[model samples]
Target chain A: MANGTVALEEKSFYEESTNKYSGILSWLLTTDHKRIGLLYLVTICAFFIVGVILGILMRLELIAPGPTIMEAQTYNTLFTLHGVIMIFLFIIPGLPAIFGNFFLPLQIGAKDVAFPRLNLLSWYIYVIGAILVLISLFLPGGPIDTGWTFYIPYSVRSTTNVSLAIFAAFVLGFSSILTGLNFITTVHRMRAPGMGWFRMPLFIWSIYSTAWIQIIATPVIGITILLVIMERAFGVGIFDPALGGDPILYQHLFWIYSHPAVYIMVLPAMGVVSEIIPTFARRTIFGYKAIAFSSLAIAFVGYLVWAHHMFTSGISDTARWIFSLLTFIVALPSGVKVFNWVATMYKGSIDPKPPFLWVMSFIVLFSIGGLTGLVLGSLATDIHLHDTYFVVAHFHYVMFGGTGTIFFGALFYWFPKMFGKMYSIKWANISVALFFIAFNMLYFPKFIMGYMGMPRRYFDYLPEFTNLQVISTVGSWLMGITMIIIFANLIYSVKKGKKSPENPWGGVTLEWHTASPPPLENFHEIPTVTHEPYDFSQLEEMKHESK
Target chain B: MNEDKQNKENHEHITPYSTYVLVWLALIALTSITVTVSGIDFGMVALAIAMLIAAVKSSLVINIFMHIKFDEPIFKVFLMVSLFTLVIIFVLTFFDLVNR
Candidate 1:
């Protein structure tokens, strides 16, 4: 086949117009999965840059104990805006919408998602949500001052554009639900001949499991957001204490979705690590079934442990004990995954590439996040750590350090295949080194100062926190500067870099078998699978040839 | 593909009109029972009974009107899993509420 498809180079999705539309209109109106994936990649990365800038600014303000830059209300609005934009616009829809939408069909040996037009519609919905958030900032009452959680009463009372902002989140959740439904149906019915459940990639498993959480957990956030809007609009008193409604109920409903939403964020990143680890290690995956099932286990147990976020919010002791136990239980499956990834690397000819290096950082940082998570998970320690920077540092470690690191890894891992371009591996490694060092300097101090009683989301702190705050602030600048190098390298390479080989990573997955920047239909003829997913022995002739 | 289609066609379910009427009557009867139970208020157990009735009514709607009775086993598995997850959420949420 011509580069794993019957078509010529002109038939690739990036080439001349197959559809009538071309240029910007082709992009907007096109339903091609790869194009939509690129669209999302650009959009979310733009939002990520904005979020990072806001974060750097926030740290700049906090560098001094007193008001360094903005007013207290501005700081409040800034963090809220930062949280809403990052959570709703960037990360939540990020890996799944970008990678999952792009690769789910490709990985499963299908031409496109089960519903192509619906796939496009979900993207439109996501864009609509992003637009709504942007418009809210300029609206009459100003942007939402409540955090992304939109804890009620405060949300109801806040004199900001809470309704419109939260309504955007509701719309975003709808997009997630549709995408979940599409992926689940695609996986169930659209696998190529002989590509059974076990034969699918671990990334598909993670995405599939995440699809369930999207379908099940996302609706709770949707409902909670609507309740917040309703209470704000009509004095519904659903969550207002002054009107005899319960505030705690809002926290419960919010985290019920948001907590599992963390799994939604991290699981696909885990799936990426699973794909990268085996490829770089030059070995068969250690425990494919174990990792696959643990994704599901984490998804399920993740749901049952949402109440852990509410431990200090006046929930019952029964709830505290029950949720604490469930929290520990959820950690088991995550540990299972970390164990399997390490085992996969054991004794293999490790490549030490950019992606693998990111995974190495992922293991160390995610484990720190996970281990400290146990401290936060316990009833006694959480009492000490609750609402402190410890909690903030913990999530950033897990979410940003872990999932965020792998985000870079997956980008680099797939960039060659996606763009048919290769950048300097040496430069990529330099960026990763700076990224890890700056990341630790930024968040690790918060863990210590947090334990010593530094509260989260404050305008001013005691004099003692000043030094650590300055270090953290300086670290943010380095990390922000490093991001420009990393992203600029990739973007420049897309136009001018060397043409990547077809199977650049010697990946045995369906995506690698096809051309770099595969044809519009993904494959000319969907190939049948007769072997295991990670059976490297079958691909001896396909060993990676470095460019 | 044709054989699978034929098998699916052969297994297609068509409930009798009388069966639909019977389910409708059962739903009505359950709704009446829920109303009666609400009036007599057996405290905590009453909420459980209400949910149990709601569950029965929905399952009837699912299996009969939704045609899950003649659908593939996987559909049934999905339905059961969804219901079980719903129960888990409710029980856990109420555990906090009641204990508090």
Candidate 2:
């Protein structure tokens, strides 16, 4: 390490890099990515708990037939809180902020993220957004129930805290944009010497693509939400139908960002799975370049297909047809990734570790989700499914089944690396299995109920749908219990589980080359990466041939 | 090694603040022209002109202030793909709007 002095200077530059902060002051003022990531991890876990409780309450009210828990407005607020917390707080930051922050610099063989201070700032902004939304709940008019999308006319006219909710959204979008900007710059400028563009890991590529989506698409939604806030606060008539403005225009603007926002949420999870599968499969990913390129393709095409959500929002037949076609086209890249994962698993030495099990389940559930997406992409079909439980089922299939599975899978994959501890494989498997079954039972019935013409957001439904709703409620409770078990297992591991090896899973990536939980600066000497990422064969060859 | 190379590339760079100013003035001029032209009765043509002017202004801002003009070619590709996708959304929605 002749350039050890350069490394030393860099280390002193980030003097507090490796050490765990002690006092409240250290925790508050730290700019370390690992600390910031831990901050997000704790915050989002709290939000997820809140959201799940809201979800449980919503389900309980629908358990019998009528208002069992609270009034209709209360129910509306409950679902709205559930939607806002789950989306903006829990899922959007699911992989990127938690795992990406923890691993991106290490994976790229760098000291820290491109802009570590900006990373800390993004977390603060996210917290501020949550506070804003929470404060809105206590305002003179109750919390907003415009269904997260906050479509105007309804949102503008309602006396609820529309301004606060939209402002919170504006702040959240900024947080997302800063993260994207950071990742994009980091990938571009901070890679090791020999790591070429295509040589980077698929997870990095996926986040890179997602970052672009965050940068470009987020601003549009920021402006859209700003206009909504203005309309609500100052009597501006941008999307107010009574003021010669088109409410539909607000829908148009909102979907422009919100549609791509879902892509932002899922793309990083897909990246995480791409990393998990090949490592566990003991094979180079089939069609690695295609999978990497497809990430960008998906993000690119994701932007074009926003109007598919609005097909029933009354644009026009021609627009609907065009959107339908574009939506189907967007499905191809995702399909490519799925096919490649399956192909990688074929005839390979697959390790059925818990992470791999979750990745396998992600492939299955994500397929169902992606296929159902095609159904909604169809104009004629969407006309029937829009705002129904079918739409709800589709989103859950993707977010819960697709991204949710990956979130857990990433936790398992990176847990040892992040905390220097190994979770119980037996319990992890049991809980994932329980979750998988409950998840399908819960959402699968929604598809049937929705196609049978049951609308979503209903406090009371037809008596015939009562059986399915009860079944869904049972499944929801089961999933909630499974989540509790999984969390307990992880917490138990952190406290008493065996200390993990630096490269416990035999992962060949740069991340495993560092100490468990990583050094504060992540690396001692900046690695001059000279091989393709995920080249497990090279590592295999380097090991002794004999036992 | 690439960092050193990049450092070399950037060191010779004259500050582009003048370029930024020039582009900003051009954007302002084009927007004013578009606002003035909107007063004429050209039906949908006015909308077309306004959007065109907007497109030009946005390109200038993206190119100069955003540093896309001096960025790596890969970033330009990413930007172009995003812009192309935005066009797809706008065109498809317009089709829906027209059909309505």
Query: Which candidate leads the pack in TM-score?
Result: 1
Docking class of 2: medium
lDDT of 2 by residue, A1-547 (tens): 0111122132321235433665665656677777777788888888988998899889889898878878899888788889988998899887888878878887888888889889989999999999999999999988988787777678877889888887998898889899989988899889877778888889999989888888988889888888887887786787876788787888888888888889988999999988998888888889999999999899888888888878777777777777789899999999899889889888778889999989988988888988999999987788888899999999999998999899899999998988888989999999989989999878999999999999999888889999999999999899899989999999999999998865677677778766666667777777677667877865553232111
lDDT score at residue B82, model 2, on the 0-100 scale = 68
Tens-digit lDDT string for candidate 1 (A52-166): 9999999999999899999888888988988988888888888999999888888878888888888889999999999999999998989888877787668888999999999
TM-score of 2: 0.92
Q: How many clashes show up per model?
A: 0, 5
The lowest-lDDT stretch of 10 consecutive residues in candidate 2 chain A is A1-10
- List TM-score per model, in order: 0.94, 0.92
RMSD of 2: 3.7
Task: Kindly give the stretch of ten consecutive residues in candidate 1 chain A with the minimal lDDT sum.
Answer: A1-10
Which runs of model 1 end up more than 4 angstroms from their true locations?
A1-10, A16-18, A541-547, B5-53
Local lDDT at B96 for model 1: 95
